[model samples]
Target: MPLWNVYHPVGAYTAQQKQEFAADVTAFYAHRGLPKFYVVTIFHEIPESSFLIGGTPSGTAVRIMIDHIAHHAPDPAARQQIDDSLTRLLAPHTRDRGLYCEFHIDETPRDLWMINGLRPPASGSEAEHLWVRENQPVPY
Candidate 1:
């Protein structure tokens, strides 16, 4: 079972938005036999104070978290495409709410996940763990 705890800052989240987002994730995970347990949290903080990069205050645009049993996915491009798709699906609902919120994704590995009494896909590659926080700086 891959569990993800998602945090949307105070101004960025609404109860309805959170529920819709969770539904999207659940459907995605259902396709692969991996259960994506969605947990949404709301917090209030300045970006500079809430996020840090290398112990320095980070000017992050968003924050998210994921926890699971641990697994892997190898295909980077495909994984990215999937993520992009998700962002697109969830973005409009948020952006329209007068929020400059960015979409953040987090995931955990699944080794022996028991979903509906079925084991999940063992693992894949590094790509499985790859997710882009859109507000991040370029990795030049």
Candidate 2:
């Protein structure tokens, strides 16, 4: 599974923008072989009074932290592609609004995680494909 934690200042994003962001982020991973259902995106709205940048309140900054199993993007190129895709895909949501944004991805070993009470199959394993097929909850 892939988990995205997106943080932005209050009033910076519309409801539609949040939905599109989630969908787009999910698609980015699905195309890389992860089951769409297992991708998760979270949007956190920070109150203007409480948000700060460079020791001052800022109205236009965003930070996204994504975590997933190592198997999802085993190659550096694949990881780089996701980062680039996120930068391009999120530009309209941030830059267009005069905001700055940053995106980061962290990979965890599959053995260190579990799903449905079971550890996911190793990357590229036949079982991994079967598990995804049986558990996928959305059509790509």
The lDDT for every candidate, in the order shown, is 0.48, 0.77
Instruction: Candidate 2: list runs displaced more than 4 Å.
Output: 70-78, 136-140
User: Per-residue alpha-carbon lDDT of model 1 for 1-140, expressed as tens digits?
Assistant: 44545444434556676667667666665555432432223344455666554687644344444443544445788668766765675566445554444544444445435444544333442222221122111221
Model 1 per-residue lDDT at 113: 51
- lDDT over C-alpha atoms for residue 32 of model 1: 56
Cα shift from native, residue 63, model 1 (Å): 2.2
Report the alpha-carbon TM-score of model 2 versus the true structure: 0.83
